[model samples]
Target: MLKKLNYTNGLLNQMKHSIILLGATGFTGKLIAEKLDKDSVTFTICGRSLEKLQYLTEKCTHNHECLVLDVMKEEKIKSVLFQYEIVINCVGPFNLWGNFIRNFCVQHGKIYIDISGEQSFIEQSFMMDKLAKEKGATIIHSVSFESCMADIIASEMLDSALKYSDISSYYFFRNSKPSPGTKLTMQLSKHFPTFFIHNGKMENASPLAFHKYISFDFLPGFTKALFMPYPEILFFNKKYKVNHSASYLMLNHSDAMFLLASRKQPIESVDKILKKHQSRKHNLNENDIAKQEFTLVVQAIAEDGIKITKYVHGRNMYGITAFLVSYLVKQINSGLLLKKGIVTPSETGAWSGLWNVLIKEKLITHVQELQSDEK
Candidate 1:
């Protein structure tokens, strides 16, 4: 049996309030650092390069510290982690370095957060859930623009629609470019099997099966979406008890074909190429980010054949992710999120609060609900 830590409100505050950002020099990491600084949140920026870390720290609007540390060095990583209450990991291809960081956090009883969208990493992390609970460590994965947006939206919709209906399916449609780190992670995760929840069980499915077009009531015309293994399936299935759920990425027909063709190449070679590309500095411009948008649609069916659909539209995936991370920190600091264990954003009991924050920040501009009677 695993041992449990004695946690009080004071201990929780002391252990879950402070922040440390790993990979602080990366694109998303830098954005998160900037937001934290803008919010005047006390945090330490850590990475392997002192020069890069210092450069980022110098640009912060508020005072912050920088640490030169390597994730591979377990002792050093653990030592540094011990000093902070929470660690916000902006590292990518989490398949490579996430396990070590996660293990250290669990063993040390530290609260951990990551914006990882890799399906394999999320699945592997779920195995640590019991251990994390035992240690009173909260590990939140996929707390980012991709999965969290879908997770929270689906969760909130389900909570409201559960009274008169059961969720038959949920779909996510995103229309935005991915960051370099996201590209790298996608390359590394291409070989993993795609999955969706069916009958309360995770089932493997072919990506090619989702090539068909889907139309949203809120959006004009039909848009092509491809099935992808998303962390939301794992997060929602456990909590919502949905019968079937699948996530799709919006893509044009040509892009869909290219995706299929690219899978034929050797995974190792592709990963090497992506890694090289990621090594270069590719920051997104404000104008380009301003043009980005995302849409999520949820469909539920009542026993009497009434179908209900919900939609949420948002902007700037990366910016929204950074803001969401900082918002979560605020909640943690305020003692609003103190659950001892691995939890999802929806499970944090802060969805309503987060929704309000998202609206307040103007990150989300539209929300709608539609009901139709079908035979």
Candidate 2:
């Protein structure tokens, strides 16, 4: 459940001395750092390797600090984290490496955000709402492409619906591959629980459950979407008071078959197989990035029997994630986010704001509201 909706103006606007970018040497981390640099946000890049940190700093147009601290070293991580008021953590699979850092941040009342979509990690973070509130900490998880965009869209739809009974989000992606960090999360998350909201309660379920085919009005044919335990399910139901909330990921026949086959294998065996696949990294060229597309369809059924559907389509997930991270930083740095506690993007009262920005930036190629009779 969300804390009280007490949105504040930029209370910390004058406190933007420095922002810390943890896991700065990773793929998504580098993208975020580059975006921050381009936006003229002063930040420090941190990782275990001084060489890689220096390399990233050298590419920045603006002056930025670099710190070489191993993630496993608790003291070092704490010392560096304490020095900055804001911390952007791109470290993952967060299910393994997230608990300590988040705990420290919450205890110290620091503003912490991470590009994590792991359901378990997010759920764990949500449990700290009380501590975060008492400590005056603002903790936001899954501020990346996987959840933040969808969360914002859902919030907008829910607000329009006013009294929503059911909400569902369908994610469609084409010609895109998961980053190494995402792959690692996928491999490790098998051990975590998958759940959904039903009648205002959480129910555990199997991964890729509730298989169904959906035909979109803007798209060509029927696409297969399976239930995926995305963080949006929790946020939508909790924040919007929706009785039922569901999230689905579009998959192809081959992908479905692969997932089903892997489900039957032992966890160890599956990890090995995934690791082998992860070894072969396919670099996406310009054409590949252009071909990669993402579409999100959010439908909410109002208590009054009205149905509202909204969708947003875009390309290049990584670029969008980077942009979203930077945008969140700007919002927090400007003290636009006034809530103090565990929060999602929408709960910050900036969902529509981010939605407008996405459209204005052309990151969202299409935004539409379909008539009830349409789809």
Candidate 3:
């Protein structure tokens, strides 16, 4: 169940000097740091390596400080986190170190955000909801390119419906390659069972269940979308009261099949391979990112047989994520987010305005809505 907490107005305005970013030396972390610097936002960068942190700080156009602290050290983590009003964690495979920071934020009543895409980590976060509400802590995970985008599009489509509707299906399509961080996260998740929402509850499902081809209005040929477990299944199902929903990845059939087959390998071997991949420099270039495109298609059906089909189109997942995190920080700093507690992007009161900004900035290129004739 979702917990509600009171929003302390003027709280954020008082926290001018209380922002720190964890994992500041990572690939996505560096992008976020660059964005923060370009926006002239005053924030401290932190990670385990002082050398890398210093390098990032120096690269920033705006002045920023760097701190070196390992998340595995509880006392050290708490001591550093206590001084910040908000922390944007870019550390990946969040199932490992995410809980430490989340617990600190809740205990200190500090706002927390992370770019985690791990379903297990997200599901585990729900247990903190009650404590977070009591402490007046606001936490939002999976603020990255895919999960948050899926949640926002789902919320928008549900809100636009004339009647109560159940999310029938959600589809994710990206024309770009995954970042090293994303690849590592995917590798880590290979051992976990895939899940989908059915009758407002989550159930384990077979990988083969999602192997079928799906058609999209924007694209000509049918594309295969593999069944994937995204955080939205839990977040959106609870917030929107969705009866049934599932997410699919737009991948070729062979690629999807290979991913499914990979699950049978030992976790240790998979982790080793992923670690090697993560060590390589695999940043997406501007020219490639500029050519990248992502699209989400959501279909919701009301009890009376009416159907609402919505399409949200965007470009460059990584660029959009950086812009989103920066925008969210600015809003939180301005006290624009009125709700406090563990929340999703759709549940935030500032989402509608943020949506407009996304469109204006071309982070979101188009949103189309269509109504079925049955109604």
Candidate 4:
């Protein structure tokens, strides 16, 4: 028998003005909660840890609540279903957890959103769109830092470009420092590859399934990066109908090592690698950034037979990520319906339509046009 959650219909409706935050104990999750608090929106922390959840909730500023509702249990999900209008899923690796929360929210007509950056998990999020819509629920996937900012920027750039030219190719380059929470989530996800997203429609490309080496001036002439094929690339490529596509990556030691260890291995084999290699402890710091910068470069081919390029830049990956998510939450809450399911940042044109929002929210420092004569 599954654990029965104590929060019921009365408690849910009582949450008239609150957001339901799943995985509230996470590093990034805590930060999302903080942002919500500052927004003056009500929210509840729902995780498997009652004591930890309680402890987390106790320190919050707004009218927040806590619930011991694990994603793995259905009955508990129902007990808490009627309480909130939106469910902000901050848990990862989303390959496993995405489906659980997504299903519950859609089935119960709860607006569901998640910050799952996993490509594989993102594919699964797309799969749920039809059902979610039929059930009259808004199911938004990839509402996190990685692709959200890119999505908004690209959408705006392309929208403006399309009015004047055709967008032939688009690329996003990103790097961010690790918050203690993000670092911890990465450690847990590697061993639990079930969190990986896969389907006959969307198969996991084996490790290095996608790769490319590109030169960038963000730092100097060139920096070597192992460009892994990301699932969200689908959102951009398919939407733009661009034949050429790639998402380059440069990960530090732990992230790079984890990606290397999880590639193409069976579940048990992957677990073995994690057990053998993972450290059980760490000293966490709030201010430590993992030495990163994520910049987006978009090249649009004008029907007039010219290639126009635009560049966008940002530092502070985690803060920027939260910033992006917070911005997205507001836009989404304002009766905007993204009827498209399973798209990359480029496909959803809302950002292009809402570029000022990105600037207003400070997600992108600048969007500048590069000289066409340079390259």
Candidate 5:
């Protein structure tokens, strides 16, 4: 349903940065802008708040242009996007505000990236594959802490020639706080169906559809894990051609808010609640980030009954997200993105051994692999 647009001018050579970042006033957006500025990558930051954007620019070393543009204005967005070769979107509740921007980028053959973890948004993004390939545009979603680690670990586990029958990823977070954008996305996601790969096909289910108790080597005992739909569920299944794939999140009753909103709650009611909730909270501070700990466990079951489990330990989810997005943007600019259509973080092969890079930067503390035979 999307058509490609032809541009006569070579905008890539004309723009100083060739990159435009939307939602630069948001939490993750600010971090990404700071990281890019620190790395000396000149870019233009656009958002609704000119004052905040100017304040951000004042603190940065580079003179990145700041533009006050509302995302809801399609014509203005299209005009601005025409001048950039790449667009990094940090807008939240992506299922709501993500469509026009993504469609515009794909139609215009621009490299589009977003840190969206909303499963519905991710599924919708996947639908753009055909159109993206036709337009010669590369669209990648969820390149942040949400599912990049899972994709990376799964790609590593598939290094052998063996065919995997099943793939599972688990996430555990400690001493961390969700950013306002993340919180809103979580609240909005409850309205969408959860998904997983079954028999090499995608299926929808309820949030926390399947629950079980599982233990990791790093944990003291078995903990409750809920089957939470994630971006990697689709990525691992499609990228690795696996028959079955699922992902889980470790949570307790107190963490029920992280799982799903009440089914009886109306959309208006939820929005009102979220507006109030987000106002009282701010981004994670350094002390909170210092205490943050996370573990990503990935397991793959081969057709021959052999299972390989890998673990990645890291700190500060948002920090990792900022660094990863910055790294991916750099890779894109350096011509490392080889695919022409919609892609997962690991599909481009640029992320191969990225775990090592994280480890080198002290973002990740440990990486281990263990193999066993299913009885």
Candidate 6:
């Protein structure tokens, strides 16, 4: 059974003096850092490579420090992390690495953010909520494209429906061309088994844990890949007073087949295969110059038989994630988030605020109203 809703309060908004990027040299880490580091907040970029750390420093016009520490060196990293006000973990294949920081953060009362969206999100997160509260830490994970966008779009569509009447059901659409960083992260994250939160309870499952096939007439039929069950569905399910909530990916059939087939393989076999594969560097265009695309669709059904759908489509998932991360930093500055606990993007209104920014920036389109008779 899922844990009871225990949303606690009383977290002081303490902006940390320095925000440390754990996976500073990676693609998403680089982008988030580039986007958020204005001349204002101080950042300390930490990773395994001193050379790469120095190389990344060149990209920052703003003042930022660099530290050579690995997350695997949990003790050292945690020591540094607690000293900072906030830490952004760009490091992943997190399940493989293990979350020692969860305890450290909870025990120490630090503000932590990460780009982790692996199937093991809550398996690694929720277990630390009480501990975090005990220590006074606020932890937000999977704040990137995977689940954050889904939650925001889902919430908005549901909210728009409430403006008319009570909501009964909803659907979310996610179409995004992931950056090279996403691909590498996928490969790294696949090192662990998949699991999810079932009825607010943590349960073991496959990585491509659950899914369905969906086709939209606007484009060719794409396979809706089963990402780990993100909190978008669960959070909105409760928030909107709906009985059912589902979201699907907008992906090519080939990619879906590849992902599913890999999921079918045993973790041991997959790791062996990865070891046997040629040593190919992780990258999309081998450089950050390449752009990607992301599409968002949120549908809500009201008791009065009305549906309102919102769309946020744009290019550059890395850039968009960066934009949202920057916004969250601002929210942190303003003290909107609650006390120490594992949080998904949907749980907070980061995505709601994100939708506004995306729309205002023309990163997303306006709302489209559909009759209940329409699909």
Point out the higher-scoring one by TM-score: 1 or 6: 1
Per-model lDDT: 0.73, 0.77, 0.73, 0.56, 0.79, 0.59
In order of appearance, the predictions have TM-scores of 0.86, 0.87, 0.86, 0.74, 0.89, 0.75
True-vs-predicted CA distance for residue 257, candidate 5, Å: 12
Candidate 2: worst 10 consecutive residues by lDDT?
Answer: 1-10
lDDT (tens digit, per residue) of candidate 3 on 266-373: 556655766787577786666677777877776677767777787778887788888878878887777775466778866665565765777888878887888885
Candidate 5 local lDDT, 148-266, one digit each (tens): 87888887777545567988898888886778887776666667777988888889976666766777657654377888788888888667767888888877655744454454555
Residue 9 alpha-carbon offset, candidate 5, angstroms: 18
lDDT (0-100) at residue 287 of candidate 5?
70
lDDT of 4 by residue, 96-209 (tens): 456766777777677666777666566556677677667777666666656565555456555432332333222333434455444544444444322112221233443344
TM-score (C-alpha, index-matched) for candidate 1: 0.86
Off by over 4 Å in 3: 1-16, 159-175, 206-209, 252-283
Better of 4 and 5 by TM-score: 5
Models, CA RMSD each: 6.5, 7.3, 6.8, 6.0, 5.3, 8.5
RMSD of 4: 6.0
Off by over 4 Å in 5: 1-17, 159-162, 252-283
lDDT of 2 by residue, 1-375 (tens): 111112124122223346889898887898899999999888877787767777777788887766666788787676667667888888887877888999999999988889888777778777889989999999988888877878887766567436667788888888877777776677766678867878867888777767777767776653777888888887775677677777888776788667667778666654574567568774644355556789888888777778888888888788888998888788767778568998887777645466667777777788888747323
Candidate 2: stretches off by over 4 Å? 1-17, 160-163, 252-255, 269-290, 351-356, 373-375
Model 5, C-alpha of 7: deviation from truth (Å)? 20
Error of 2 at 346 (Å): 1.3
